[model samples]
Target: MDVSWEESVADSINTIYLLFSAYLVFVMQLGFAMLCAGSVRAKNAMNIMLTNVVDAVVGSISYYVFGFAFAFGEGSNSNPFIGTYFFALKDIPNSTYDYSFFLYQWAFAIAVAGITSGSIAERTQFSAYLIFSFFLTGFVYPIVAHWVWSSSGWLSPSSSDMLFGSGAIDFAGSGVVHLVGGIAGLWGALIEGPRAGRFDAFGKPVPMRGHNATLVVLGTFLLWFGWFGFNPGSFDKILVPYTTTSDQGNWTAIGRTAVTTTLAGSTAGLVTLFGRRLLVGHWDALDVCNGLLGGFVAITSGCSVVEPWAAIICGFVSAWVLIGLNITALKLKFDDPLEATQLHGGCGAWGLIFTGLFAKEEFVIQAYDSGESGVSRPYGLFMGGGWALVGAQVIEVLAIVGWVSATMGPLFYALHKLKILRISVDEEMAGLDISSHGGYAYTSHAEESQPRFYADYARLQDQS
Candidate 1:
């Protein structure tokens, strides 16, 4: 075959690979919907489900209009903080990126909103959700993506003047996607406070378990399936040969990434299973599912560069990180219905730190495209690299926290002040489904009669 033909074939393969991955990532929306629906009380199921559906719908429009531009638009004069070109997706499908790339990224942007939705699930007003979801996907999340994932980003590995000679290595956005969403959720939940009756008058905890375990398991498995694409699919091209004569290429690294992701999630699930058993004297499937997700969140930063063994370590530590955070949240009376802040925020921070400690030299070189640049980038500290990578990773954590706090924190607080964040107490007691939406998710003859019975009772009391 001619050289031009070979190049064409390579481009076609890469495009197909990316489109397939985008589909897989989009399937995660179903996973998020099912998981959120299962985690909240039955009374609020419909409300939470609707928010999850709207996350995708609203996020798509906002991200397409400006979020993608703020993230990856690189003109001749590119800035480190944010992109200035490609607004409204004009001039896209250019030399640098294609529509498939945009589709894949849109899937990710919506996932951030999905994560935040879980934090304030049961008590939040539908209107408040609409406002925050639009702002986050359009602005807050994109800025962070620009800082970490964009080529011109100051924290990006592809940056010209890298931080500490080694920019933050968030290979798959543990910090960018998970941490941003988690922190945003944290502020929203904090401002809204816990669901009604979530705590006793004495400030002690109350058990507000989800209404469905089957849906939780179904969602967890679906997320696990989608993660195959989430981690390995981040490699936009799979057809590039590593060298002219070598058989190895990005395909090998992609497989390794998939393996590491699986191992980390599996290890975290097992640890959470036994650990929770020891702590609470019962094997809880829900804890295992969250632990598994926490593992995936932590390993997302270093999944491409870490060894399989290191991924296992990442999972184990992440499980405990989640458990400890949950305990602390309870103590502080911070009630997140789905533990989004703990699982994503806390574990995602740990994932970035884990990458700084476990990333291997050869894998880092192969994964990061630093070999051609002749720049010997820093690897993990424990791998004998130095403090440079560690320092850079720490900077990324602090910057994400600060940025999300400054943007999303105040957005939620303003919503609270406007008296539109949470529902009224009577509405909360009656449940969002009945009070806000039309009715309950599940209904029966008995349930149908109860509403009329309550109406009659109230009427008689008023007359008397």
Candidate 2:
């Protein structure tokens, strides 16, 4: 075959691979919907589910308009902090990136909003959801994505002037996507305060379990499945050969990444299962599911570069990180219905640190530098690469925390001050489904009558 024909064929295959991955990632939105629906009380299920759905719908428009531009837009004027090109997808499908890449990134942008929604799920105003979702996907998240994934990003491993000779190796955005979402959620939950009845007069925590365990399990599985695409598909191209003469290629690294993800998540689930059993005296599926997701979040930064055994260590540590955070949150009387802030924020930071400690040298070269030999770059600290990579990872963790706090913290605070961030006390107590959305998620004759019955009873009591 002619060289031109071969190049065209390769391009077609890569595009197909990326598009398939994007579709898989998109399926995660459904997972988040189910997870959120299952994790909240029956009264607030509809409200939370609505927020999850709007996360995707609203995120799509905002990301298309400015998120993609601020993330990966490349031109002579493009800076490291934000992209100035590709506004509204102008000059897209160019030689460097195609539409499929945009679809993939958009899926990621929406996932960040989905994460934040979980933290402020039951108590947040629907209008607040719309405003924050749009702003996050349009501005906050894309800037971080630019800082890590874009070529010009100072934190990007692919940058010309690498930080510490090995810019942050967030292969799949443990810091960028997960940390940003988690920190944003942190500010939102802090601003909104806990849901009603979450704390008693003594300031002790109360048990406000989700309405459905089945939906939580289902959502967890779906997210687990979608993560295959989330981590492995970050490669963007599966056809590239690692070495011109070697049989192994990017395809091999893809498989290894998938393995690492699976191992880490599985290990975390098991650890959380037993750990929680020891702490709480029983097995909790919901806790395990969250632990599994935490593992996935932690390993995402180094899935391509870490060994499977190292992934297990990452998982093990992440489970405890989650547990400790949950305990601390409770001690502080801070409440997040879905534990989104703890799972994503605490474990995501650990994942970045884990990558800095355990990333393998050869694997790093293959994944980041396209297996180009003789390229002097730092690797994991434990692997004898020195403190450079770990230092970079630490800087990344701090920078993300600072940036999200600066942006999202103010946005949430502003919404709170305006009295629009959370629903009214009566509306919250009655449930957002009936008060805001106009119906129950699982409506029945009795369920429908109960609300009216309560209204009449309250009116009668007031009259008496």
lDDT on C-alpha atoms for all candidate structures: 0.90, 0.90
The clash numbers for all candidates, in the given order, read 0, 0
| Model 1 error, position 135 (Å) | 0.5
lDDT of 2 at 389: 95
Best of the candidates, TM-score: 2
> Stretches of candidate 1 above 4 Å error?
1-3, 76-78, 93-97, 370-375, 445-449, 452-464
Model 2 per-residue lDDT tens digits across residues 89-168? 78655544568899999999999999999999888889999999999999999998998998889998899888888899
The CA lDDT at 137 in model 2 is 98
